[model samples]
Every structure is written in structure tokens, then in C-alpha cells.
Target: MIGSFVLLNCKKNREKEVMMQLKKIPEIKEIQCLTGPYDILIKVESPTIEELNETITWKIRKISDVRTTYTLKINEEATDCKDDN
Candidate 1:
């Protein structure tokens, strides 16, 4: 499966609204409220890059009050440090 992390910064006081909308998306496996430059962190998984892009563009980005979004696609071949333990 393909995976990615979506960093979102929405309008002030709209985090809850955004979270509510994000939860409804099936590809969204995890969502967390954040601080600093980004207000929220989203973890998603899909079978293809095209679907991942579609979800970002048509679903998440379509939500009202979403100011900015940055997506970081994961490299599935890389080994995680945790796996060695």
C-alpha cells in the first residue's frame, strides 16, 4: 500500500471542523491535532498514488476553511528503526 502524511493548516478555530470532516474519509487511518506551523497531522494509506492524490485534492482540500496543505508521501521500501528491535 502507498502511504503519506498530510500536514494541514486551517483557519483559526476551525480545527475541530476540519477533524470532523477528515474522520469521514476511509483512507485516513489516523489524525492528530498539532501545534507550530501546522495545525493537524493526517496519516493515510492507499493502493495507488493516483488515489492518494485524488483524496488529497478532491476530499481533504475540498473542505471549507482549509487554508493550506502539504503532503509527504512515504517510501515503503525504507526500513524503520523500530523493526530492528
Candidate 2:
């Protein structure tokens, strides 16, 4: 699986509506409201890079009032660092 942290901006006053819309997508595992330039943050996962792109480009970006999306892909190497004990 692939994981990503996505920061997005929504139209003024549409944050809640956008959040509700975003919750319907299964690929988006988590969502949170923000305080800075970004209005919302989300975590997404997919089995393949192509599917991830489709989720971001089509499923996410297509949502009404969504202005922009900045994606931070989770480093697979770092995620493997777990307590060996």
C-alpha cells in the first residue's frame, strides 16, 4: 500500500461541505481541519501509484470548492522503521 498526506484549500466558507464530500471517498482514510494557508488535511492510501494519482486527480480534485491539493507521499523506507525488540 501507498500512503500520502494531502493538504488542500477550499472555497471560503465551504470547508464543512467539502469535508462532508471528502468523507465519502474510501481512499481518504483521515481528514482534519487546518489553520494556515491550507483549510483541510487528509491522509490517503492506495495499492498502486496509478490508483493514487487517479484518487488525487479525479476523486479528490473533482470535489466542488476544492481549490488546490499538495500531496506529501509517505516514504516507504521510513514507514518500515519499527521497534525491532
Give candidates' CA RMSD values in order: 1.9, 2.2
Off by over 4 Å in 1: 77-80, 83-85
Score every model by TM-score.
0.90, 0.88
Instruction: State the displacement of the C-alpha of residue 13, model 1, in Å, after optimal TM-score superposition.
Output: 0.5
lDDT of each: 0.94, 0.94
| Predicted structure 2: lDDT | 0.94
Candidate 1 lDDT, 1-85, residue by residue in tens: 8999999999999999999999999999999999899999999888999999999999999999799999999986466656655
Candidate 1: 10-residue stretch with minimal lDDT: 76-85
- Candidate 2 lDDT over 5-70, as tens digits, reads 999999999999999999999999999999999999999999998999999999999997999999
